[model samples]
Target chain A: MLNSYSSADKVLLAVDCIIFGFDHEGLKILLIKRDFEPEKGKWSLMGGFLRKDEVLDSAAIRILDNYTGLQDIYMEQLYTYSEINRDPVERTISVAYYALINIENHNAELTQNYHAQWFSVAQAPKLIFDHDSMVEHAIRRLRYRTSIKPVGFELLPEKFTMRQLLELYEAILSKELDKRNFISKINSLDILVKLEEKDMMSSRKGSYLYTFDKEKYDAKLLNDFVLNL
Target chain B: MLNSYSSADKVLLAVDCIIFGFDHEGLKILLIKRDFEPEKGKWSLMGGFLRKDEVLDSAAIRILDNYTGLQDIYMEQLYTYSEINRDPVERTISVAYYALINIENHNAELTQNYHAQWFSVAQAPKLIFDHDSMVEHAIRRLRYRTSIKPVGFELLPEKFTMRQLLELYEAILSKELDKRNFISKINSLDILVKLEEKDMMSSRKGSYLYTFDKEKYDAKLLNDFVLNL
Candidate 1:
């Protein structure tokens, strides 16, 4: 069945994952050592080929799992690079996907086995092919996504304080957003659930912890659009 | 040279276009009659194969030129579609692009030869191979783009009346927007040049004609964002 559906212009299909993470330090991206022919021992994003029956999203998830061993990750299709000779080995077109995951929830053993390491947004090393451009576009998109939606929640733990949320936005935008303005904007969106509990570890005045109210957020999403224009 | 880059798994690459246009009536899209086997004669978006040595944008332009004989079109790479068997004939992954062009500028003979027709958003025919979904996504993107930038000008004539401008947004959004509010929102953007001419065809009080100030718009684009939300 597969043979009958073959093509004369057979091209190689690959998936590149832009894995994003946020921690107390700031936002980061995961990179790995290739350890294979061509660009062996150099830094690169986690990637794999698309199986005959798998969708692009699944392939991105598969690649994400290979490095992090995490399921149900937040991943989005970014772009496709089809420049001939992008891969020195063949005529490969890479479909890029960006994933947002909590840094504190990753599997350390799996990442270590894959020689994976996280680098701050300002410090990721040079990558192979057009991977660097993919990362740049993903960061721009992350800034855009972070502006409208409560995407900070995606990169944070289940329960977090307003300061952590502000820091996450600061990392993504690479700018200092006014705290008063930021809190007002988040309140205007009305998507967070304020809890009675407070995170007492960070400050003398314990800041209140909030969990995302998915029900209200999804309901309000119908009338509201996230454009931090 | 090509043989040096052979791979074990080869895939098929296809190109799909989201052609947008505007006339006096409203925003329109171009659909072609599928003239080949396996859903022949069904309505489908304009499309073709990607030949070697061509950039993805170049191939999109080539396809648009073949069917419409129009050049210098406003086209952007939207997304890549890679559902296995979306195209039943082969396991083809199509890179989808969206283009905005003035409908009257295209070569009439070429358009007729391809059996293409301009259908307003309300009357487009049922399309094949997930094209309906593609068109739906393109419309949503068109709305987002028009709100954020001076893109509505692309869908109008070089000189158009204020009424035509308002109708363009209405047609794109598929909603009746309040005229006063719409005018204020547009005036705040400050991207148009109101000419000393009036269009008398629309009303007793002739409406002012405006042309897009391209030079000024481009200059302001770097630091400024134009969103109507």
Candidate 2:
């Protein structure tokens, strides 16, 4: 019997983060220019090697925090990419994680320090080392997540207009949704708190703002409801 | 600049499979009594250390085939488990995959050779080295997959009665479903074809047998639809 662990080969494990943000422009992802060899100067997802002592989740959190100086963001383990020669330098398996962050909240100095920038997911540059496929998979997962969860709460400002909320869904789904149906469905969820404050930027009449009810949103997280948009 | 990969720690990567099969008894997961130390005789998911040349998907398939002698099974990358000391003997990160197979189709002799046995998912014994949590996660993913895909077709016989289909869903969801509502929702999916044949063993008035429409199933795979049962 091969009873010992000494004979098994060990390989480097990397964690790459697909940090998603949303603004009036649409959904975007945080990308950094690689400063190391093999894919240096190319656009790529922010990533780092997993130390022996760190767990995968912590590694993902550490990488995301390192790049954006943002904490407590909504992040999930997306997928593990393990194509041979995926990393030109060595045999490395990358576990991809995706995070939803409010765009305006991240520190500008931190992003500038790492040379990270946000690009619209639709028009993002071709990425390095299977990162393109990772982004595509993340978008599909995000779309599925949006139907079941109120992702707009994470991406949109605390006080957002109905149009902003609808646009967030449209961007994630990559399609146009009927305005009437969208608002009705959102109303049915009953987790949004309509605010007295109005955003008067779009028109003189102004539009009422809303915020996600945290207690109700947390309840919905526990008991998932289908928002068939 | 730290540009080389030579200094980073490399950890052993393993792939553990939660092989799910369905019989009249309900959903069962294949588990093996470990023959090698450090947890000899304890139940564990069928698993193996991934070789340097192998991808995770291939490693999962190899492990499943090694135990069940089944090939071309429907498998998916579920998640990666990386608690710092998940494995007793080494620093290892396990990428878990789940497979759906027909219980009657696997080779009994091969399973016997490996001391692998099917246990009702509800009554599965305690497993070693974080495997219990792995099974729990797999079952959750299976339940989610059931809502979006025709998983009964993968776990059931080629032609099945409506009772078998309902039972499969019940086992996966662990809840009794309303028969009329279940059938209506399934009918709306338009993926099942009622056949002229009947399973005479169930009753004097044998229930009608049905087979999934492969073309429609393929289409649904490409364009996902919700099955709110």
Candidate 3:
């Protein structure tokens, strides 16, 4: 290779993931206690240094997989943070990715092995370095993504009740939405298919279950639609 | 410094900018012919390697200023491209930023010095490296930003006609929008202040010009609104 860029300064690159999961409780984020210095024992997003031969997307996937033992999760690159001293131990530019995974799907053993735990996004601990800001940024991105993409479905079970879907949006938006208006707005997008199945656990009169119509949802994705919440 | 991350690999980071500008002709991007080795004379986005001491945002601003002699332009980080060998000269990861500028405000002399020229995004020649992909990504982001934020105003003059605004959206969306629907949707945002001043360039009766109400626009930005183009 021609050493054309030899004069350029090189810096360490890190990939960090904000793993968002949803449950009956609310929106949650997976965090782990750092096992090594300089911020050992402190809560931080699952992260690792990017290897020379790895692409950033792969690095994020690797980091997430290493922590959760989950593969093919819905992940999107949120933003890159390069605050000069964001990583005090080195000059590191970290690319932050946000992943949406069904809360029930992660391996409990793997998570426990890494000292990883899920905390409600509203109640997550003050994280180390710039991670708190990263989480805040990721939440904002998640809320925005909820409007344009069917990403919320990634955090829900294969079959979900209307109330569950509404709760998921409310959690992601961090606010209360009128149930009627929310359902109407969501239905207007024409991405959900009402299933004959019902969940008897939530009410005396069970509520109907619905699953995202993948074909229509994908078609809507290609021709973007706005869902005013 | 602790050097706790001493074993981590270091790679060169580059900041490339897609400078979007608008005029009577339509939407355009600023491109420069590479004067350096490997891809000399090939058109590419204005870019530079990030310095060790500089933050990524500062690097983006500095690169933009260097190429256009413009400052404080509206710029946002779009995405980072790290394909291991995206740059043939080195293992360089580039953070792409999209900048919106008024076409008339750039320093023509400075641009000429760097062999920079404006090309309609639709008609621009093939760019070197992964820059073509970078431009495409930036355009997608710019469209997303347009719906949530009043960033489209950055590419327009301080005062513009309703027709000009419609044309701007059409260019960014790459589709002709219904004039009535576009006007009503924009008026509903209530972010524009119609002025007594009129531009007679396109019509004998003259078209009323409007400017963004900065306070309302900023407020709307804080409480995000959707503008479906």
DockQ of each: 0.32, 0.43, 0.44
Please state the CAPRI-style docking class of candidate 3.
acceptable
TM-score of each: 0.88, 0.90, 0.91
User: Per-residue lDDT for B12-87 in model 2, tens only?
Assistant: 9999989887776778888888778899989988888889899999998888777667678768999999998888
Which regions of candidate 2 are displaced past 4 Å? A107-111, A188-201, A213-229, B107-111, B214-229
Best by DockQ: 3
Q: Candidate 1 — which residues are off by over 4 angstroms?
A: A1-8, A107-111, A213-216, A219-229, B1-7, B107-111, B190-197, B211-229
- Residue-wise C-alpha lDDT for candidate 3, range B88-147, written one tens digit per residue: 877899999987677876655455556678899999999999999989888887777565
How does residue A37 of candidate 2 score in lDDT? 88
Rank the candidate models, highest TM-score first.
3, 2, 1
lDDT of 2 by residue, A35-93 (tens): 88888899998888998889988988887777667677657999999999999899899
DockQ value of candidate 3? 0.44
Q: Which stretches of candidate 3 lie over 4 Å from their true place?
A: A1-4, A107-111, A221-229, B1-4, B107-111, B221-229
lDDT of 1 by residue, B9-28 (tens): 66777778888877667778
Each candidate: what lDDT? 0.75, 0.80, 0.79
- Give the range of the ten consecutive residues with the poorest summed lDDT in model 2 chain A: A220-229
